[model samples]
Target: METKRLNKAISETGYCSRREADRLIEAGKVKVNGTVVGLGVQVSPDDKIELEGKLISKEVENIYIAFNKPVGIICTTDTSIKNNIIDYIGHPERIFPIGRLDKPSDGLIFLTNDGDIVNKVLRSGNNHEKEYIVSVDRKITKTFIREMSSGVPVLGTVTKKCEVERIADHTFKIILTQGLNRQIRRMCSYMGYEVTRLQRVRIMNINLDDLKVGEYRYFTPSETEEINRLVANSGKTMDASFD
Candidate 1:
């Protein structure tokens, strides 16, 4: 069997994200085959793994969850205090959000144990589109729409030319491939408009139609397979860049 990165193996077991796995491993909390392991180690399926003095017997299972995140809940796994999405969902298997929508923004957020899929979905070069409906404090003019669609400077960088069309007097829909931190809000601010409300409506081909806020649904088997194919194709495309 092929050996996988220790972080990948640890994440597959649903303990935490790969980054978190590194922290645990570096802290001398993880052991493989009765030996305390270090960073950048690889493990195979036959290896026994333990964390924090306990042997982890839980077999990793791939799980995908689509959640309608309501405003206010942070999309983080640091559940040391109050409400976090992880504790809110309460899934038996540990899953992390694919990408984040800000606390003030709410909509379709994907939670899954499929680490490889997350990389594909979030990679900018993959060109997976995220659609959002944003409401501004004032009416949106045609000039403003044109300029916004052209590309606006948020902080030091100019955003890519994205699809921005008016949906209502003060409301518009936008599609973006980049998942910059609080991107939409910052973009609108740069255009001299205060975003009164923002909600992500879609992620790639997935939509949040009829899913109530705070509710979640598992991806169907066919959906899962299709997504896997898309991700695999993306991987091949990325690999060719180095050749």
Candidate 2:
């Protein structure tokens, strides 16, 4: 059997992302065959792997869920932090969030044990659309809409041009193909507006319609099939451009 990096092996098990696995290895929390291993160590599928002293096996059943995340709930698997999404859902299996929604924002977010899907969905170069409904502190204006639809500079890079439409005097909807840190919020702030409320309504073909806050449901087989087809050609590696 071919050997793989310790972090990669751990990530494929659906316990966490490769970056989180590296952190655990650096902290001496990962043991291989009863011996703690350092970063970049290689191990095979037959090797014994323990994370935080508990054995981790490759997940046999691939679980995919769409969660209606509530405001103030963080999108992280770290059990140490209070009110993390993982503890909130309390799933029997270990699953990490596919991407993230800021703590202050809420709406549709996906959780899955399939790490390969996580990498594919997060590659900004794939041009997957994420739709959001936002209400700002000030009245919506044509100039604001035009600027938002055109592009906004945030996080040292200009955001990609995307679909933006007014929903109300103070509310609007946007569809983004790229995920930047707090992209919507930063864009509004740059336009002299403060987002009073923000909620994701759709991600690709998945929609949050009628899904209440703090609720979750499994993705139907059809949904999974369609998602797989959408990301079939997306890169499995994390793209640096997304950072």
Candidate 3:
């Protein structure tokens, strides 16, 4: 029988990526053959791997879900946090949000058990498109459109040029390729405006569509394929600093 690192074995069970498996091991939630094991521990193929006292099966299926996160729900995996996204999702299988939407802001967020794709999708340099409709405390202006689409200085650097268009007197749609913390809000604030409401409507090729707030659905086979293709060249190790 072949021997593998504990993390590799756990990841091979389709429970998570090797990095997440290492996290679980470090958290003291992973055990081998009824005994707690530390990182770098090697095990035979026949050895049993358990996480949180539950046996991890090698045949576990990967899960992908797109959720319309409503306002006030946090984009955190920590169930202990009040109104965390994971608990609200109530998925039978373990899943984590790919990225975050601020607690006060709401829209589409992807949750998945496939840890391999998370970083790729979230990598700021990947230039994947994320669309949003933002409402400001004041009416929209022509100068605002020109300056916002040009670039806005915030978060110690200028935001990348994005597509901005008026959707209403106080609402507009913007598509961004990079995400800095409170980026849109900061940009608007820098221009003497304040974001009153923000909602993400699209990420990459996916859209929130008619999915009501707080509802979720599995990605269609075509959507999954296209997503994979889009991120195929993105490195999984890079920082997903974008929202």
Whole-structure CA lDDT of model 3: 0.86
> Per-residue lDDT for 44-141 in model 3, tens only?
97888889989876665677788999999999878889999988988888788877899999999998877777778877888889999999988999
TM-scores of the candidates are 0.88, 0.89, 0.83
Better of 2 and 3 by TM-score: 2
Q: After superposition, which runs of candidate 3 have C-alpha atoms over 4 Å from their true positions? A: 1-58
Q: Write the per-residue lDDT of candidate 1 for residues 107-181, one digit (tens) a residue.
A: 898999865566567776777788999999989999888988999887578888889999999999999877676
- Runs in model 2 lying further than 4 Å from the true structure: 35-42, 239-243
Each model's Cα RMSD: 4.1, 2.4, 3.2
For residue 68, give model 2's deviation from the true position in Å. Answer: 0.7
> How many clashing pairs does model 3 include?
0
lDDT of each: 0.80, 0.88, 0.86
Give per-residue lDDT, candidate 2, residue 26.
97
TM-score of 3: 0.83
